[model samples]
Target chain A: MKNLIKNFFAVEEVSAHCDGPCGVYDPADARIKAEAVLSMTKKILAMAAPDPSDAAAVVAYNNTMSRYIAIKEDQAHGTKTDILVLWTDFFKPQHLEATPDLHDKIWKATKLCSACKTTVSLESAEALMAAVEDIHNIFWAAKGRDVAYYTAS
Target chain B: MQKYPENAGFFEYVLLLLGRRKRIRVTGASMLPGLKDGDELFVDPYAYVATHPEEGDIVLAWHPREADLKIIKRVSMVLDNGCWLVGDNPAESTDSSQYGIFAFKRIVGKVTSRS
Candidate 1:
Protein backbone atom coordinates (compact mmCIF):
# COMPACT_ATOMS: atom_id res chain seq x y z
CA MET A 1 0.00 0.00 0.00
CA LYS A 2 1.04 3.59 -0.60
CA ASN A 3 0.53 4.30 3.08
CA LEU A 4 2.86 1.47 4.02
CA ILE A 5 5.54 2.61 1.58
CA LYS A 6 5.22 6.20 2.73
CA ASN A 7 5.48 5.12 6.36
CA PHE A 8 8.50 3.02 5.52
CA PHE A 9 10.24 5.95 3.89
CA ALA A 10 8.90 8.40 6.46
CA VAL A 11 10.64 11.30 4.78
CA GLU A 12 10.44 13.89 7.47
CA GLU A 13 10.06 17.56 6.64
CA VAL A 14 13.09 19.85 6.98
CA SER A 15 13.35 23.60 7.15
CA ALA A 16 15.66 26.48 6.40
CA HIS A 17 15.42 28.61 9.47
CA CYS A 18 16.98 31.91 10.46
CA ASP A 19 18.75 33.63 13.41
CA GLY A 20 22.29 32.55 12.48
CA PRO A 21 23.70 29.03 12.31
CA CYS A 22 23.03 27.35 15.62
CA GLY A 23 25.63 26.76 18.34
CA VAL A 24 28.54 28.63 16.77
CA TYR A 25 29.45 30.43 19.94
CA ASP A 26 32.91 29.91 21.40
CA PRO A 27 34.59 32.29 23.91
CA ALA A 28 38.03 31.07 22.91
CA ASP A 29 38.25 33.68 20.16
CA ALA A 30 37.76 36.48 22.64
CA ARG A 31 40.24 34.92 25.04
CA ILE A 32 42.94 34.71 22.40
CA LYS A 33 42.47 38.31 21.34
CA ALA A 34 42.35 39.49 24.94
CA GLU A 35 45.57 37.60 25.64
CA ALA A 36 47.24 39.50 22.81
CA VAL A 37 45.95 42.73 24.32
CA LEU A 38 47.44 41.77 27.66
CA SER A 39 50.78 40.79 26.15
CA MET A 40 51.07 43.99 24.14
CA THR A 41 50.17 46.09 27.17
CA LYS A 42 52.91 44.38 29.15
CA LYS A 43 55.51 44.97 26.50
CA ILE A 44 54.57 48.62 26.16
CA LEU A 45 54.66 49.19 29.91
CA ALA A 46 58.07 47.54 30.21
CA MET A 47 59.71 49.46 27.38
CA ALA A 48 62.17 52.05 28.73
CA ALA A 49 61.79 55.61 27.53
CA PRO A 50 64.26 56.33 24.74
CA ASP A 51 67.11 58.79 25.39
CA PRO A 52 65.63 62.26 25.16
CA SER A 53 68.91 63.61 23.77
CA ASP A 54 69.20 61.11 20.86
CA ALA A 55 66.65 61.72 18.12
CA ALA A 56 67.37 58.31 16.49
CA ALA A 57 66.79 56.37 19.69
CA VAL A 58 63.64 58.32 20.39
CA VAL A 59 62.32 57.69 16.91
CA ALA A 60 63.10 53.97 17.13
CA TYR A 61 61.48 53.73 20.54
CA ASN A 62 58.50 55.67 19.28
CA ASN A 63 58.27 53.31 16.32
CA THR A 64 58.36 50.22 18.50
CA MET A 65 55.99 51.66 21.11
CA SER A 66 53.58 52.80 18.41
CA ARG A 67 53.56 49.31 16.89
CA TYR A 68 52.78 47.83 20.28
CA ILE A 69 50.00 50.31 20.87
CA ALA A 70 48.55 49.58 17.44
CA ILE A 71 48.55 45.85 18.09
CA LYS A 72 47.07 46.31 21.56
CA GLU A 73 44.27 48.47 20.29
CA ASP A 74 43.55 46.15 17.39
CA GLN A 75 43.40 43.10 19.60
CA ALA A 76 41.23 44.80 22.19
CA HIS A 77 38.80 45.86 19.50
CA GLY A 78 38.73 42.33 18.14
CA THR A 79 38.06 40.93 21.60
CA LYS A 80 35.20 43.35 22.01
CA THR A 81 33.69 42.27 18.69
CA ASP A 82 33.92 38.58 19.59
CA ILE A 83 32.31 39.18 22.99
CA LEU A 84 29.57 41.37 21.56
CA VAL A 85 28.76 38.73 18.96
CA LEU A 86 28.36 36.16 21.71
CA TRP A 87 26.23 38.52 23.71
CA THR A 88 23.99 39.50 20.85
CA ASP A 89 23.92 36.38 18.69
CA PHE A 90 24.47 33.51 21.09
CA PHE A 91 22.81 34.34 24.42
CA LYS A 92 19.04 34.11 24.66
CA PRO A 93 16.32 35.31 27.05
CA GLN A 94 16.21 32.02 28.95
CA HIS A 95 19.89 32.44 29.74
CA LEU A 96 18.99 35.68 31.49
CA GLU A 97 16.79 33.76 33.89
CA ALA A 98 19.85 31.84 35.05
CA THR A 99 22.26 34.77 35.04
CA PRO A 100 20.20 37.86 35.67
CA ASP A 101 23.32 40.01 35.50
CA LEU A 102 24.06 38.83 31.96
CA HIS A 103 23.47 42.29 30.55
CA ASP A 104 25.75 43.96 33.07
CA LYS A 105 28.42 41.31 32.56
CA ILE A 106 28.57 41.75 28.78
CA TRP A 107 28.38 45.55 29.09
CA LYS A 108 31.31 45.62 31.50
CA ALA A 109 33.31 43.20 29.36
CA THR A 110 32.87 45.46 26.35
CA LYS A 111 33.76 48.51 28.44
CA LEU A 112 36.93 46.79 29.58
CA CYS A 113 37.78 46.12 25.97
CA SER A 114 37.55 49.84 25.26
CA ALA A 115 39.63 50.67 28.35
CA CYS A 116 42.31 48.25 27.27
CA LYS A 117 42.45 49.89 23.87
CA THR A 118 42.66 53.46 25.23
CA THR A 119 45.38 52.79 27.79
CA VAL A 120 48.38 50.54 28.21
CA SER A 121 47.22 49.45 31.64
CA LEU A 122 48.31 45.99 32.66
CA GLU A 123 45.52 46.05 35.24
CA SER A 124 42.87 46.61 32.56
CA ALA A 125 44.38 43.92 30.34
CA GLU A 126 44.30 41.37 33.15
CA ALA A 127 40.76 42.41 33.99
CA LEU A 128 39.75 41.87 30.38
CA MET A 129 41.21 38.37 30.45
CA ALA A 130 39.32 37.56 33.66
CA ALA A 131 36.12 38.89 32.20
CA VAL A 132 36.62 36.87 29.05
CA GLU A 133 37.21 33.73 31.09
CA ASP A 134 34.02 34.36 33.02
CA ILE A 135 32.13 34.73 29.77
CA HIS A 136 33.74 31.53 28.52
CA ASN A 137 32.38 29.66 31.53
CA ILE A 138 28.96 31.23 31.21
CA PHE A 139 28.74 30.49 27.49
CA TRP A 140 29.72 26.84 27.95
CA ALA A 141 27.34 26.44 30.87
CA ALA A 142 24.43 27.73 28.82
CA LYS A 143 25.18 25.15 26.13
CA GLY A 144 25.43 22.45 28.81
CA ARG A 145 28.82 21.62 27.44
CA ASP A 146 31.86 21.45 29.67
CA VAL A 147 34.38 23.07 27.38
CA ALA A 148 37.68 23.73 29.11
CA TYR A 149 38.93 27.25 28.43
CA TYR A 150 42.60 27.69 27.69
CA THR A 151 44.77 30.61 26.61
CA ALA A 152 47.41 30.32 23.91
CA SER A 153 49.55 32.90 25.68
CA MET B 1 7.49 11.78 -30.96
CA GLN B 2 10.94 12.77 -29.73
CA LYS B 3 11.56 14.94 -26.72
CA TYR B 4 14.26 17.61 -27.16
CA PRO B 5 14.97 18.29 -23.52
CA GLU B 6 13.50 19.05 -20.15
CA ASN B 7 15.43 20.36 -17.17
CA ALA B 8 18.97 19.28 -18.00
CA GLY B 9 19.91 18.57 -14.38
CA PHE B 10 17.03 16.13 -13.88
CA PHE B 11 18.78 13.40 -15.84
CA GLU B 12 21.90 13.65 -13.68
CA TYR B 13 19.79 13.79 -10.56
CA VAL B 14 17.93 10.63 -11.53
CA LEU B 15 21.13 8.70 -12.16
CA LEU B 16 22.88 9.70 -8.92
CA LEU B 17 19.83 9.75 -6.63
CA LEU B 18 19.31 5.97 -6.90
CA GLY B 19 17.87 4.60 -3.61
CA ARG B 20 18.71 7.70 -1.56
CA ARG B 21 15.86 9.77 -2.90
CA LYS B 22 14.50 12.25 -0.43
CA ARG B 23 11.92 14.82 -1.33
CA ILE B 24 12.31 18.26 0.22
CA ARG B 25 9.92 21.17 -0.01
CA VAL B 26 11.83 24.40 0.10
CA THR B 27 10.16 27.04 2.22
CA GLY B 28 12.72 29.78 2.63
CA ALA B 29 13.98 32.63 0.48
CA SER B 30 17.59 31.76 1.20
CA MET B 31 18.01 30.15 -2.19
CA LEU B 32 16.20 32.77 -4.25
CA PRO B 33 16.93 33.31 -7.95
CA GLY B 34 17.51 29.59 -8.56
CA LEU B 35 15.19 27.88 -6.07
CA LYS B 36 11.98 29.37 -4.77
CA ASP B 37 9.63 28.64 -1.93
CA GLY B 38 7.34 25.59 -2.47
CA ASP B 39 9.70 24.09 -5.00
CA GLU B 40 10.08 20.34 -4.77
CA LEU B 41 13.64 19.04 -4.66
CA PHE B 42 15.26 15.63 -4.51
CA VAL B 43 18.39 14.99 -2.48
CA ASP B 44 21.26 12.67 -3.32
CA PRO B 45 22.33 11.36 0.08
CA TYR B 46 25.25 9.50 -1.42
CA ALA B 47 26.52 12.51 -3.34
CA TYR B 48 29.24 13.27 -0.84
CA VAL B 49 29.96 9.80 0.51
CA ALA B 50 33.08 9.13 -1.53
CA THR B 51 33.96 12.75 -2.25
CA HIS B 52 33.82 15.91 -0.21
CA PRO B 53 31.60 18.91 -0.66
CA GLU B 54 33.13 21.62 -2.81
CA GLU B 55 32.50 25.30 -3.08
CA GLY B 56 29.37 26.24 -5.04
CA ASP B 57 27.69 22.91 -4.27
CA ILE B 58 24.28 23.23 -2.67
CA VAL B 59 23.65 20.91 0.24
CA LEU B 60 21.18 20.03 2.93
CA ALA B 61 22.67 19.80 6.37
CA TRP B 62 21.66 19.52 10.01
CA HIS B 63 21.34 22.82 11.78
CA PRO B 64 24.48 22.86 13.90
CA ARG B 65 22.62 23.99 17.00
CA GLU B 66 19.28 22.30 16.44
CA ALA B 67 19.96 18.75 15.40
CA ASP B 68 16.38 18.03 14.38
CA LEU B 69 16.22 20.86 11.90
CA LYS B 70 17.69 20.30 8.48
CA ILE B 71 18.65 23.33 6.40
CA ILE B 72 19.64 23.90 2.79
CA LYS B 73 22.52 26.22 1.95
CA ARG B 74 25.27 26.55 -0.60
CA VAL B 75 28.83 25.68 0.31
CA SER B 76 31.03 28.78 0.10
CA MET B 77 34.24 27.53 1.59
CA VAL B 78 35.67 24.17 2.59
CA LEU B 79 37.65 24.28 5.81
CA ASP B 80 39.77 21.72 7.57
CA ASN B 81 36.96 20.48 9.81
CA GLY B 82 33.88 21.69 7.95
CA CYS B 83 32.28 23.86 5.33
CA TRP B 84 31.19 27.48 5.33
CA LEU B 85 27.73 27.87 3.87
CA VAL B 86 25.69 30.85 2.87
CA GLY B 87 22.27 31.39 1.44
CA ASP B 88 22.08 32.46 -2.16
CA ASN B 89 19.81 35.26 -1.11
CA PRO B 90 22.31 36.99 1.15
CA ALA B 91 19.85 39.65 2.19
CA GLU B 92 17.42 37.09 3.52
CA SER B 93 19.63 34.21 4.52
CA THR B 94 21.34 33.89 7.88
CA ASP B 95 24.28 31.62 7.30
CA SER B 96 28.01 31.40 8.02
CA SER B 97 28.02 35.09 8.80
CA GLN B 98 25.43 34.47 11.47
CA TYR B 99 26.83 31.26 12.84
CA GLY B 100 30.45 30.34 12.18
CA ILE B 101 31.32 26.97 10.68
CA PHE B 102 29.37 23.77 10.14
CA ALA B 103 31.00 20.40 10.73
CA PHE B 104 31.33 18.36 7.53
CA LYS B 105 29.60 15.41 9.13
CA ARG B 106 26.43 17.42 9.48
CA ILE B 107 25.89 17.50 5.74
CA VAL B 108 23.01 15.20 4.69
CA GLY B 109 23.45 15.37 0.93
CA LYS B 110 23.65 17.47 -2.21
CA VAL B 111 20.56 19.18 -3.55
CA THR B 112 20.48 17.43 -6.89
CA SER B 113 17.58 18.87 -8.89
CA ARG B 114 14.08 20.25 -8.93
CA SER B 115 11.39 17.62 -8.92
Candidate 2:
Protein backbone atom coordinates (compact mmCIF):
# COMPACT_ATOMS: atom_id res chain seq x y z
CA MET A 1 0.00 0.00 0.00
CA LYS A 2 2.84 2.40 0.81
CA ASN A 3 4.71 1.59 -2.36
CA LEU A 4 1.55 2.09 -4.38
CA ILE A 5 1.04 5.49 -2.78
CA LYS A 6 4.69 6.43 -3.31
CA ASN A 7 4.30 5.62 -6.96
CA PHE A 8 1.03 7.53 -7.06
CA PHE A 9 2.63 10.68 -5.67
CA ALA A 10 5.79 9.97 -7.70
CA VAL A 11 7.48 13.07 -6.37
CA GLU A 12 11.17 12.36 -6.82
CA GLU A 13 12.38 14.47 -3.91
CA VAL A 14 11.12 16.97 -1.40
CA SER A 15 13.02 20.17 -1.99
CA ALA A 16 12.50 21.33 1.54
CA HIS A 17 11.30 19.98 4.85
CA CYS A 18 8.57 22.62 4.82
CA ASP A 19 6.74 23.93 1.76
CA GLY A 20 10.02 23.96 -0.18
CA PRO A 21 11.71 27.37 -0.58
CA CYS A 22 8.94 29.87 -0.97
CA GLY A 23 11.34 32.76 -0.13
CA VAL A 24 8.71 34.13 2.22
CA TYR A 25 10.32 35.05 5.55
CA ASP A 26 9.49 37.99 7.76
CA PRO A 27 10.64 38.75 11.32
CA ALA A 28 7.87 41.31 11.37
CA ASP A 29 5.48 38.55 12.37
CA ALA A 30 7.36 37.90 15.58
CA ARG A 31 7.75 41.61 16.13
CA ILE A 32 4.04 42.29 15.85
CA LYS A 33 3.08 39.55 18.28
CA ALA A 34 5.78 40.49 20.71
CA GLU A 35 4.60 44.09 20.58
CA ALA A 36 1.05 43.03 21.33
CA VAL A 37 2.20 41.05 24.35
CA LEU A 38 4.10 44.06 25.63
CA SER A 39 1.17 46.39 25.06
CA MET A 40 -1.31 44.10 26.84
CA THR A 41 1.05 43.68 29.78
CA LYS A 42 1.36 47.42 30.19
CA LYS A 43 -2.38 47.91 29.92
CA ILE A 44 -3.10 45.28 32.55
CA LEU A 45 -0.59 46.78 35.02
CA ALA A 46 -1.88 50.30 34.51
CA MET A 47 -5.51 49.27 35.11
CA ALA A 48 -6.72 50.15 38.64
CA ALA A 49 -7.61 47.48 41.22
CA PRO A 50 -11.41 47.86 41.55
CA ASP A 51 -12.88 49.02 44.90
CA PRO A 52 -13.75 45.98 47.03
CA SER A 53 -17.02 47.53 48.23
CA ASP A 54 -18.36 48.56 44.81
CA ALA A 55 -19.82 45.54 42.92
CA ALA A 56 -20.02 47.34 39.55
CA ALA A 57 -16.41 48.59 39.79
CA VAL A 58 -15.19 45.05 40.66
CA VAL A 59 -17.01 43.54 37.66
CA ALA A 60 -15.54 46.11 35.27
CA TYR A 61 -12.04 45.50 36.69
CA ASN A 62 -12.43 41.72 36.30
CA ASN A 63 -13.60 42.07 32.69
CA THR A 64 -10.73 44.37 31.74
CA MET A 65 -8.14 42.21 33.46
CA SER A 66 -9.45 39.02 31.78
CA ARG A 67 -9.46 40.62 28.35
CA TYR A 68 -5.92 41.94 28.72
CA ILE A 69 -4.68 38.59 30.01
CA ALA A 70 -6.27 36.73 27.10
CA ILE A 71 -4.66 39.00 24.51
CA LYS A 72 -1.29 38.79 26.22
CA GLU A 73 -1.39 34.99 26.26
CA ASP A 74 -2.51 34.73 22.65
CA GLN A 75 0.12 37.13 21.39
CA ALA A 76 2.87 35.51 23.43
CA HIS A 77 2.05 32.17 21.81
CA GLY A 78 1.97 33.85 18.44
CA THR A 79 5.47 35.22 18.94
CA LYS A 80 6.74 31.76 19.78
CA THR A 81 5.14 30.29 16.67
CA ASP A 82 6.56 33.00 14.44
CA ILE A 83 10.06 32.59 15.81
CA LEU A 84 9.88 28.79 15.56
CA VAL A 85 8.98 28.85 11.88
CA LEU A 86 11.89 31.14 11.08
CA TRP A 87 14.28 29.00 13.10
CA THR A 88 13.13 25.78 11.45
CA ASP A 89 12.32 26.79 7.89
CA PHE A 90 14.05 30.06 7.01
CA PHE A 91 17.29 29.95 8.96
CA LYS A 92 19.89 27.48 7.72
CA PRO A 93 23.36 26.30 8.74
CA GLN A 94 25.00 29.18 6.94
CA HIS A 95 22.91 31.58 8.96
CA LEU A 96 24.09 29.91 12.14
CA GLU A 97 27.72 30.30 11.12
CA ALA A 98 27.13 33.93 10.34
CA THR A 99 25.44 34.52 13.69
CA PRO A 100 27.12 32.28 16.24
CA ASP A 101 24.66 33.08 19.02
CA LEU A 102 21.57 32.59 16.88
CA HIS A 103 20.38 29.46 18.68
CA ASP A 104 20.91 30.91 22.14
CA LYS A 105 19.20 34.12 21.18
CA ILE A 106 16.14 32.36 19.85
CA TRP A 107 16.01 30.09 22.88
CA LYS A 108 16.09 33.04 25.27
CA ALA A 109 13.48 34.90 23.24
CA THR A 110 11.06 31.94 23.20
CA LYS A 111 11.51 31.45 26.93
CA LEU A 112 10.72 35.10 27.51
CA CYS A 113 7.61 34.68 25.38
CA SER A 114 6.52 31.89 27.69
CA ALA A 115 7.37 34.00 30.72
CA CYS A 116 5.14 36.80 29.46
CA LYS A 117 2.29 34.35 28.96
CA THR A 118 2.63 32.99 32.49
CA THR A 119 2.94 36.30 34.29
CA VAL A 120 1.60 39.85 33.91
CA SER A 121 4.83 41.59 34.91
CA LEU A 122 6.05 44.62 32.94
CA GLU A 123 9.64 43.41 33.44
CA SER A 124 8.89 40.08 31.73
CA ALA A 125 7.19 41.83 28.83
CA GLU A 126 10.13 44.24 28.42
CA ALA A 127 12.58 41.32 28.45
CA LEU A 128 10.52 39.63 25.77
CA MET A 129 10.77 42.77 23.61
CA ALA A 130 14.54 42.90 24.06
CA ALA A 131 14.89 39.26 23.05
CA VAL A 132 12.69 39.82 20.00
CA GLU A 133 14.84 42.80 19.06
CA ASP A 134 17.90 40.58 19.09
CA ILE A 135 16.14 38.13 16.81
CA HIS A 136 14.96 40.91 14.54
CA ASN A 137 18.47 42.24 14.08
CA ILE A 138 19.81 38.80 13.30
CA PHE A 139 17.02 38.05 10.86
CA TRP A 140 17.51 41.23 8.89
CA ALA A 141 21.27 40.82 8.98
CA ALA A 142 20.85 37.32 7.51
CA LYS A 143 18.69 38.77 4.77
CA GLY A 144 21.15 41.66 4.15
CA ARG A 145 18.31 44.07 4.83
CA ASP A 146 18.92 47.39 6.54
CA VAL A 147 15.68 47.60 8.48
CA ALA A 148 15.93 49.87 11.49
CA TYR A 149 14.58 48.79 14.87
CA TYR A 150 11.76 50.93 16.32
CA THR A 151 9.69 50.40 19.44
CA ALA A 152 6.07 51.22 20.29
CA SER A 153 7.21 53.56 23.05
CA MET B 1 33.40 -17.73 -31.80
CA GLN B 2 30.70 -15.31 -33.03
CA LYS B 3 30.55 -11.58 -32.48
CA TYR B 4 27.85 -10.58 -29.98
CA PRO B 5 26.88 -7.38 -31.88
CA GLU B 6 23.96 -9.16 -33.54
CA ASN B 7 22.78 -10.47 -30.16
CA ALA B 8 22.88 -7.14 -28.41
CA GLY B 9 19.07 -6.80 -28.45
CA PHE B 10 18.64 -10.34 -27.23
CA PHE B 11 21.11 -9.85 -24.40
CA GLU B 12 19.35 -6.67 -23.25
CA TYR B 13 15.96 -8.38 -23.39
CA VAL B 14 17.33 -11.24 -21.28
CA LEU B 15 18.71 -8.78 -18.72
CA LEU B 16 15.31 -7.07 -18.49
CA LEU B 17 13.52 -10.41 -18.22
CA LEU B 18 15.90 -11.53 -15.49
CA GLY B 19 15.24 -8.31 -13.50
CA ARG B 20 18.80 -7.12 -13.99
CA ARG B 21 17.61 -3.93 -15.67
CA LYS B 22 14.62 -1.84 -14.65
CA ARG B 23 12.78 1.27 -15.72
CA ILE B 24 11.60 3.72 -13.07
CA ARG B 25 10.26 7.21 -13.43
CA VAL B 26 12.30 9.80 -11.61
CA THR B 27 10.11 11.83 -9.26
CA GLY B 28 12.09 14.46 -7.33
CA ALA B 29 14.22 17.56 -7.77
CA SER B 30 17.23 16.37 -5.78
CA MET B 31 19.17 15.80 -9.00
CA LEU B 32 18.06 18.88 -10.82
CA PRO B 33 20.23 20.20 -13.73
CA GLY B 34 20.94 16.53 -14.56
CA LEU B 35 17.64 14.73 -14.03
CA LYS B 36 14.26 16.36 -13.77
CA ASP B 37 11.07 15.20 -12.14
CA GLY B 38 9.00 12.74 -14.21
CA ASP B 39 12.09 11.66 -16.18
CA GLU B 40 12.22 7.95 -16.98
CA LEU B 41 15.41 6.21 -15.94
CA PHE B 42 16.87 2.93 -17.15
CA VAL B 43 18.45 1.21 -14.21
CA ASP B 44 21.11 -1.50 -14.28
CA PRO B 45 20.41 -3.58 -11.21
CA TYR B 46 23.68 -5.42 -11.71
CA ALA B 47 25.84 -2.32 -12.02
CA TYR B 48 27.01 -2.60 -8.44
CA VAL B 49 26.60 -6.32 -8.01
CA ALA B 50 30.23 -7.17 -8.71
CA THR B 51 31.82 -3.74 -8.21
CA HIS B 52 31.32 -0.92 -5.74
CA PRO B 53 29.40 2.16 -6.74
CA GLU B 54 31.66 5.03 -7.89
CA GLU B 55 31.30 8.65 -6.95
CA GLY B 56 28.89 10.69 -9.16
CA ASP B 57 26.81 7.64 -10.03
CA ILE B 58 23.09 8.23 -9.55
CA VAL B 59 21.60 5.31 -7.67
CA LEU B 60 18.18 4.09 -6.58
CA ALA B 61 18.06 2.88 -3.00
CA TRP B 62 15.63 2.45 -0.16
CA HIS B 63 15.50 5.46 2.14
CA PRO B 64 17.50 5.02 5.33
CA ARG B 65 14.56 5.97 7.55
CA GLU B 66 11.83 4.44 5.46
CA ALA B 67 12.74 1.06 4.00
CA ASP B 68 9.85 1.13 1.56
CA LEU B 69 10.67 4.59 0.26
CA LYS B 70 12.87 4.48 -2.84
CA ILE B 71 15.22 7.43 -3.17
CA ILE B 72 17.50 8.48 -6.01
CA LYS B 73 20.75 10.16 -4.99
CA ARG B 74 24.24 10.59 -6.35
CA VAL B 75 27.21 8.84 -4.80
CA SER B 76 29.23 11.73 -3.40
CA MET B 77 31.92 9.54 -1.92
CA VAL B 78 32.64 5.84 -1.45
CA LEU B 79 33.38 5.72 2.24
CA ASP B 80 35.12 2.93 4.14
CA ASN B 81 31.97 2.55 6.23
CA GLY B 82 29.40 3.14 3.48
CA CYS B 83 28.76 5.14 0.37
CA TRP B 84 28.01 8.83 0.99
CA LEU B 85 25.13 10.02 -1.16
CA VAL B 86 24.52 13.70 -1.78
CA GLY B 87 21.97 15.48 -3.88
CA ASP B 88 22.96 17.63 -6.83
CA ASN B 89 20.93 20.48 -5.42
CA PRO B 90 22.16 20.56 -1.86
CA ALA B 91 19.87 23.42 -0.85
CA GLU B 92 16.81 21.41 -1.74
CA SER B 93 17.80 17.87 -0.84
CA THR B 94 17.83 16.00 2.42
CA ASP B 95 20.63 13.50 1.81
CA SER B 96 22.86 11.19 3.86
CA SER B 97 23.68 14.04 6.20
CA GLN B 98 20.08 14.14 7.43
CA TYR B 99 19.15 10.44 7.10
CA GLY B 100 22.51 8.74 7.75
CA ILE B 101 24.51 6.31 5.57
CA PHE B 102 22.66 4.15 3.06
CA ALA B 103 23.47 0.45 3.29
CA PHE B 104 24.67 -1.38 0.20
CA LYS B 105 21.86 -3.90 0.56
CA ARG B 106 19.36 -1.08 0.33
CA ILE B 107 20.71 -0.01 -3.05
CA VAL B 108 18.50 -1.43 -5.77
CA GLY B 109 20.30 -0.22 -8.89
CA LYS B 110 22.56 2.33 -10.55
CA VAL B 111 20.83 4.74 -12.91
CA THR B 112 22.61 3.93 -16.20
CA SER B 113 20.40 5.94 -18.51
CA ARG B 114 17.76 8.63 -18.18
CA SER B 115 15.35 10.47 -20.47
> Please, what are the lDDT tens digits per residue for candidate 1 over residues B1-115?
2111124254544453356666677876667657767766667788888888988888898887775888888899999999999887665677888788988888888876655
lDDT of 2 by residue, B1-115 (tens): 2111121234444555566656667665566656667766556778888888887778877776754677778888887667888777565577787767877777777876542
Residue-level lDDT of model 1, residues A41-152, one tens digit each, is: 9999899997799999999999999999999999999999999989876776679998999999999999999999998789999999999999999999998989998889
Could you say which candidate leads in TM-score? 1
The weakest ten consecutive residues by lDDT in model 2 chain B span B1-10
Over the stretch A1-153, how does candidate 2's per-residue lDDT look in tens digits? 323322333223322221235347788888888999989999998998977999999999999899999999999999999998888867877789899888898888899989999998889888888888888899899889999988665
Candidate 1: stretches off by over 4 Å: A1-9, A17-23, B1-115
TM-score of candidate 1 on Cα atoms, chains taken together: 0.56
lDDT of each: 0.80, 0.74
Docking class of 2: incorrect
What candidate 2 gets wrong by more than 4 Å, as runs, is: A1-22, A151-153, B1-115
